[model samples]
Target: MKTSLQTTAFAFATSAVLAAPALADEWRLNNFLPETRPESAQIEKFAEDVNTALAEKDFSIEVYHGGSLGLPNTDLLRVVPTGAVEMSLMWANYLGRDAPALGSVFVQGAISTVDELTDVLPVAQEIYEEEYSEWDVTTVGFVAIPTLSVSVFCRDEPVNTLEDLRNVKLRVWAREQVETFERLGVAAQIIPQEETYVALRTGVVDCALYPALYAKTISLQEVTGYASFLYPMASAPYALGVSDALWESTDPEIRDAITQAADDLWDRTNQYDADIENEMAARESLAEEGIVWSEDFPESDRALFVEAVSETWKMLAEEAGGNALDYRERMLTALGR
Candidate 1:
């Protein structure tokens, strides 16, 4: 009983609905930091950016923060290459056992400040691309959250001078940090980030070296009485990597969009960190709450520390050998040292 015009319109609508494609790809991005940290916020921003940029594409990114995926920070390099997870923000130094050259970023005094770290990133990116490719992953980019320094937080007394660190038990993250402390005559213990708070409170370690933002995250200021804003001995290089298979299979346009999103995220996060006002204000708030902030150690002590840590780099380079050694040399040259 339908008119010929009405029947034609009904047929056209059915074909259009059937022709529309469903969302076919979903990517999982794993992050180790809790959602509250700026690092995690940036990761979330990256997801949103990529999704928006690729709105016409049939792909989506879902971020899993705070290790909700049950992957430890150390297992990222091993797990991410298998295509089980589409991407991850991994701490580069955790792979030191197998890739010492990649771990070199965590070597105390290797890069000094965030500006130096930024300057060396091009060379670092090349090294990471070559190295991560071998593991079947594609490097997205390197991220520096906040800045490149770690402050000392202590329970018994303030570490205002290098001499104060002598014989003091401190919690460290990597072998490079341990070697750096050893050179200063301090006892260093490798502690996982999750366990550091309880260890500090229970007196298992007298002092700890961590980013100031992290201290606030774990509420260490409530447990520790002093903090010293020392020049960074080492900064963990954070890298975002995607599975090589996924990268190859993605549409070319989508791939380009994702890359652009990564670059945008890096620029935006660096600008946020460079502002300094937010960080200083947070520190001031902490100070008002009774945390004693010590003056920076003398330049002479910093010089000696840098010199001593440089020796450790030579040992690392020799140990890493082959491409790692080459990469290390390239990084050193890039740093103009």
Candidate 2:
């Protein structure tokens, strides 16, 4: 009996020793984008950087990209809460069904540039945190792709003016995009980004609207001939949200390390966009690679487009059940509008 008691105590001590190592060394993170694209490349880099930083502190992390661990793009909010997965970089707009306020952000055409968003991200972050926390999610930091400036990349007909928007079959990614483009008379069809090139090549779509980064990343410039500089009407940002339960379980030091690295990436991304000289250089490079950019549409024409969508603010406010109106007032008050 004495020998058996000693063996039992030894086994218990061994189990405790094993559990301590598990607590120190293992982690899993998910990124939903394909590695072929530039923005996705940046996300991969961020993950690698985090892993490297943690390793320097005698820890390690495993990163699953392209939704390798699971279809995080569609199921993370569900999976994360149940501990099916640990961490993720979530795009707010895609989670619209769960978080309507996210989609509401795209309602107005006023926030045209990254510079404008920089001032407003704090308020947006606060709003998202409040909403996401209900689902047991936490936002680590936001990663923005340099202006998702939508371009009408057409196969046969290039859209140069507002009149060209009429009856044009285009691919749209968001409901707000559909509504706003429909108001401009576009025959919009919703489709995923992966299918856009095939849709354009097969004549299923006459034109498609997406970011310059996407165009450059996927060689969409080869299928389309011209781009319209519709600045405000076509700009957006992507965000990254983490699983709150996972965050709470993480060692506070590891959590701080990841958050700090993500914050650095945000600053890097913002710097990349804020450097007008670099953006101009990128534009020139893309132009050299067969992308045609038109300078024909002047400020007055741009103003006309904004004027045409003048009721967006009111419509959005109504859609947001007065909260959007509150947001709008906040933005306007910030700008002294």
Candidate 3:
């Protein structure tokens, strides 16, 4: 009953429908840190830049901070490559058991200065890429946090030497710190940063192994009057990881844009060696807040601490168990230590 003209038109409509491209849903990026941190701002800017470049693409990005999407930090290595989550900023030190290779890559006390840390980062980045690829993910970017210097802040008196630390309870952040201090014969315990102020005020701990730059955050000057510099606080920077599936599917132009944005982030953090400068400024501010600073933690004692920490690093590599020793040696070589 249909005319030839009508049949032809129907055929043309079906062809057009078949030729249309399928648009993708918004890609989500999970940030495990609070929105208040400076690094969050940098990440948001990265997303903004990438989205701008991706305006013509079928896909876009939306960053979710503080794990609002219920993605667990500990399970990132297992979950990231499966494409269940498209992208995430992973904190390596927190994932010791989930991915030992990641934890073995680096730690907080690895270096004594930001410059030294930066010098060794090229090697570290390589390890990160290699380890993440095994999980079927690609490294896209890095978010460098503030370089807070590690120090001991005590409530009433100056914690000057090894013996002073042994006299009063010392609060530390992780097992690494606990082991390092215990090896030096100091009584130390793991106390969460958020609860540190309350712990110090209530006499639960007499001293805390904290960062001077961050002391102002919890107003440590109020509870702790004495502080001493220990070393440059170093840890693995948050890594921006993309699922290999998603990365491979991306258009080349968009992919380049993402890579450019990530490169910009790395350059931003290292440009002026400004993080250490900021830490120095914060120390001065803490002093203004009535906190007295000291350099009485002698080089002799520091050498002992570093030696103990080095042993812990080896233990971490052994637990990781997959050419982790090679990675450690490469890192040590880069550090010239």
Candidate 4:
């Protein structure tokens, strides 16, 4: 009886979601990040453009910030396809556990510089389209998350090199990271971003990988005393995924507006690299708060880390069981590896 009731509830939720778009003459875009984020502003602008373009048609695009629809970021793979949300910002890296083929295509942690990041994106975008197309989710545009430097923070030990991480338990965000570190013979765990400081304070994790620009946002300085710039951390931009269901029903004029907005989304951000100045500013701020900066990763170690992470990427692709291996090869060739 309980199982049947749960199934009924899910069915009702699905129906309600499917019905929301056309009947209301409004297409909802679900962005899980808060409105205050720099990227959210662009998304809002995208919606406004779409709504304005469709003004004559009695249709509108509504922007819901901070996951107001109560959707988990990870569930977007299925949600967007099913029209649970007409559109959404899906962080490909965050969805790795579910779509290894797309998610692990390029682990930003594996990349060391902005040029390398640039090289990988075209390949990653292809895989995203190929795999997402398999489920009928269209990749409209992307918001480029700048190449914020990755800082390895620890409470007691300073992680300046690969060898330095050996004695400490690292807290990484994804299983691929956990496995990559594990392959290096270090004990690593997956800790949610919100609980990282607590985990560090309570001795649950000895180190964590965080962007240097936002370390203070999570109060990493309060618990961890030392940090090192480990990599450039050019994370895959948030993908603007639109459902085919909604797209097919929309007029071409409205589609052109969305396409133009998305194309301009990338161009708008290309005006400046948001992280370069901010990361240095953050480092100085963290230093004032008593956080000691350590030597950045040596080229030798960066190369080593890239290799370890690459192995995990291959393993993920092979296990994902589709055109994953083929996609992985294209990614490697793009990287010139």
Candidate whose TM-score is highest: 1
Model 3 lDDT vs. the true structure?
A: 0.76
RMSD of each: 12.1, 9.7, 11.6, 4.1
- Name the lDDT of candidate 1: 0.73
RMSD of 4: 4.1
The alpha-carbon lDDT assigned to residue 66 of candidate 4 equals 71
| Cα TM-score of candidate 2 | 0.79
Taking the tens digit of each residue's C-alpha lDDT, what string does model 1 give over 1-337?
Answer: 1133234433443343224322347787878787878788888888998898877776788888877776667665666665556788877677776556676544656666666767776677677788878777798876665554567889888886788877578988788778877877778889987788899999999999876756677778877888887676325457899878878988888788789888888787664344356657766877887889888777888887787788887777787777767877788787787
Write one digit per residue (lDDT tens) for candidate 4, span 216-288.
6678999999999877666766788877777788778878888898888877764335568888988999999
For each candidate in turn, the TM-score is 0.85, 0.79, 0.79, 0.84
RMSD of 3: 11.6
User: Which ranges in model 4 have alpha carbons more than 4 Å from their true place?
Assistant: 1-23, 55-58, 201-203, 270-275, 298-300
Model 3, total clashes: 0
Candidate 2 Cα errors over 4 Å, as ranges: 1-26, 56-58, 66-76, 232-237, 272-275, 295-301, 308-310, 322-329
- True-vs-predicted CA distance for residue 219, candidate 1, Å: 1.6
Error of 2 at 295 (Å): 4.6
After TM-score superposition, the amount by which residue 292's alpha carbon in candidate 2 deviates from its true location, in angstroms, is: 3.4
